[model samples]
Target: MVIGAGPVGENVVDRVRAGGLTAAIVESELIGGECSYWACMPSKALLRPAIARSDARKVAGLRESVYGPLDAMEVFAHRDKVVGHWKDGGQVDWLDSIDVRVFRGHGRLHGPRKVEVTSPEGERHVLTARHAVAVCTGTRALLPELPGLPAAHPWTSREATSSDRVPERLVVVGGGVVGVEMATAYQALGAKVTLLVRGGGLLPRMEPFLGEHVAAALTARGADVRTDTAVSAVVRDGGTGPVTVLLEGGDHVEGDEVLFATGRKPRTEDIGLETVGLAPGSWLDVDDSLRVTGSDWLYAVGDVNHRALMTHQGKYQARIAGAAIAARAQGGDSALDTGRWGAHAATADHAAVTQVVFSDPEAAAVGLTLAEAERAGYRVRAVDLDMRSVAGAGLYAQGYRGHARMVVDLDREVVLGAAFVGPGIGELLHSATVAVTGEVPIARLWHAVPAYPTLSEAWLRLLEAYRG
Candidate 1:
């Protein structure tokens, strides 16, 4: 039995059936999960229109104007269209075609080989699993405990994505991916956006310069990006009107709506996990093999297991878990370790890997930041360069201020990490990712050659700047 039919769960179930095994899918929410229906699907729907309209605003066909605003209704409609109107009839048919049984309700583990599901109509069935039971129950949003904040009208990612109306003024309480993306989208849709960040800078997870570019681009787009600002409390300006936010600095800002994009925590609560006689956070842990610790009959995958939170990463984790379970069921020695699979392994968790912030200008990064590298006791060489010298920059935009960095293992003569920030540098990350993952020697990486007149030429330029 597969618990949670999110993308990861669905992928696992499909894989199980393809192995000629009988599998049942249990879901209590939308089948496609956040990516297909809410998080990625709708957010991208909102952004694509702006990106296309912006492109059309350039020296291109029809050069249409008066396209003026992003119609939220249209965006929502498009999202629904992509999700097939949120009707699972199509999904249900496909699941049936795959010969997998579907159980609609909240499912919980009863024992080592037992799954108990409560149907929507109050019907209950005890399913005795003949094969392995996989838990793909994904993560849930983490809400910060700010004083008097819950009383105010606050929009989670869900409320914001499904919004049919745009607020006149918006206060986004976090500077993470969701906050910046929503802020940009709504700012384009004509909202006065004020983003408050508790961190020292935005995208603190990436390089400082990358964070600077994102903050600059957001400010360029008319968003008031405030770093080092925290919300003390949220006061309902009562009587069904706009909300007012009081910052820790004794200042106040009012907006038609407030959004909380703080972060996310795994969804391990109230699922009857304790009945398994396993401790929380430890037993539900997915090993490199994607197996639940101490139990071969049970496994957990995706964000709920806290493996990797990104939808894409969760799906990959689920795929590994699914394959492992299938192999074991077929009586194969499927005992696998997470140490191998460079870039594919859980190695990145211990050693930081490439990550890019997908804000307007975008920021790409791989491996440790300068501070982190130094702290980890690496004899390091770090250099930063203006992105314009690289051919990739000139092609990105006539007026583009980009940044690039190269972190060298000075002793090993290899590149430890690299980062690029500015328009279109997001794709340029793959080259850096390859370099870091392959542990490519700096001298050899020079010969890895980026095409002429491309942003990637920045790689070679960065190498030169390293020596200077």
Candidate 2:
């Protein structure tokens, strides 16, 4: 049985059925989960037009023609179409074809191996799992506790992504992926955007240069990128007027809409974790196979496990967990391969996790940063390349300002991590992911020649810089 039919849960059930096991999935909301409706799909849809226009503006002859603001309505319409107008019929049909039982309700742990589901009509049903129960309830946007925030009707990630109309003025409070991406989208769609980052830099989790490039680009696009700014309170008169965000000092910024993209908390608050001797609202600890710690039958996949919050990472975990459960059900512990990089192990969660921020001058990275690699006690060398020097990048854009950094493990002679910050660099991330995940040696990478006159040639440049 799977609780919360998000992408993670759906993947779990799909894999379980593929493993020749009967499965049931329970969800209170849509079948495809957050990625299908609110978070990834809609957010990316909103970003693509903005990014495309921005890229076009950088081209030589095309720059003059694409300078106008995006058609906000058309962009919203396209976004709506991408999300199937917030419908899940197709997703439901796919599940039906898979022969997976779907329970439309709020599913909670009744006890060991048992789930109690309450439907929207308040009808109750209990299900007992034959092998395992996977909890894939993803997270919701976390709004900080501040004065008048709730009363002011602040927008979380869901509202930010799914809103039909763009606000005239948007005050985004966070430096994370959601904050930067939305700021980029709204600014391009003809909104005055003020991005408030409590931290000193954006994309703080990645290399420092990535955030630096993104900040410069956002500022160049006329966004008010404020760093080290802390919000003390927020107020909106009559709950329908402009939101006034009070800063730590005697200062404030007003906007037609305020978005809090500070962070995310697990959605396990009311999923009956207390019944299973776990905290009611906490991230579930899991082993390499995604099974909840100290329990054989309980597996926590996706954001609920706090392994890697990205949808793709969650789906990866689901695949591993589903396979592990099947193996255990078939032939006990002997049937499972629990070693690192094994068929049932999610080792990549620790070693080769990848992320791409859809902000202007896209930031993509995999594995460790230079700081992260050094902190991990590896003997590392940081090789840097100005992406503008690459022939392909120069042809791709007029200025083509960007940077690439590859952290090499000197002892092992393998790529430890890599980050690229520039326009259209999102596609260049997978090669880095492959290098880090495969632990491909620096010598071997030198032989893996990159195609000339492409942004990918940045790899060859990085290798040459490392050789120097």
Candidate 3:
């Protein structure tokens, strides 16, 4: 049985059924999960037009043609289309086609291998899993506890991404992916946007230079990117009026809407973890195969396990967990393969976690950064390059300004990590992901050459910088 029928849960059930196991999946909300309606799909849909226009304006011939604000209605319509009109009928059909039983309700654990589902109509159903139960419930937006903040009814990622009408003026709190992307989208759609970052800079998890580059670009595009700022209080008339965000320094920012895109916490609080000897709100601890520690029949995949929060990473965990569950079910303990990169192991979570932040001058990275590599006790050489030096980048954009960095593990002679910040680096990340995951040697990488007059040539330049 798989609880929380998001993409991760759906993938888990798919793998389990492929391994010849009967499975049932349960979801309380939309079957396709957050990514479908409120996250990856809708968010990307809203950002793509602005991104495309930016890309076009960078090109010489197209620069003269592209100008002005994006059609807000058109963008919202496209986002609606991308989210399938916020409906799950198609997802349901696909799940049904796969022969997985679909249960619509809130699913909670009723002790070992037992699930109790409460339907919307006040009906209840109990399910027993003979083999294993996988928890694939993801996370929710975490709002900071400020006095009267809840009363102000601020937008989280959900409201920010799925909102049909752009706020006239948006004050976005937090400088992470959600905050930056929503700020960028609304700014492009004609909203006066002010991004408040409590930390030193934006995209703080990536290389510092990446954050600097993104911050500069956002500023160039007319966003008030304020760093080292925090909100201390909030005021709204009746939870639906203009929001006044009081800053830490006694000043306040008033806007038509205020968004707290702070971060996310696991959605495990109400999922019945306490019934099975686990804390209700705590993150679930799991082994490499995604099995809950000390429990053979219970598994936790996706954000609920706190392994990795990204959608793609969660789906990868689901595949591994599903395979492990099937093996343990069919052939018992002896059939399990728990070695690193084994059939059932989730090795990439530890070594090659990849992230792409879809903001202007997009930020992308795979594996560990220079600090991470050094802290891991690896002898490392970090190489940096101005991405503008790449011939392809110049051709792609006349005055292309960006940076790329590669962290090499000297002892292993392999790339430990890579980061790219530029107009079109989102597509460049997977190559780094492959290099890190495959542990591709630097010598071998020299021969797998990137074609000229493309952003990919940045890889060749990094290699050259490393050799120098």
Q: What lDDT tens digits, residue by residue, belong to model 1 across residues 244-289?
A: 8899879988898999999887666756677788654332676765
Model 2: per-residue Cα lDDT over 343-425, one tens digit each: 99999899889999999899999999999888899999999999988999988888889999999999999998999999999
For each candidate, give its TM-score against the true structure. 0.89, 0.99, 0.99
Model 1 lDDT on a 0 to 1 scale: 0.77
Residue 38 C-alpha lDDT in model 1: 71
Name the candidate that leads on lDDT. 2
Ranked by lDDT from best down, the candidates are: 2, 3, 1
400 in model 2: Cα distance from truth in Å?
0.7
Error in Å for residue 235 of model 3: 1.1
Q: How does residue 137 of candidate 2 score in lDDT?
A: 95
The lDDT for every candidate, in the order shown, is: 0.77, 0.93, 0.91
Error of 3 at 326 (Å): 0.7
User: What is the number of residue pairs that collide in model 3?
Assistant: 0
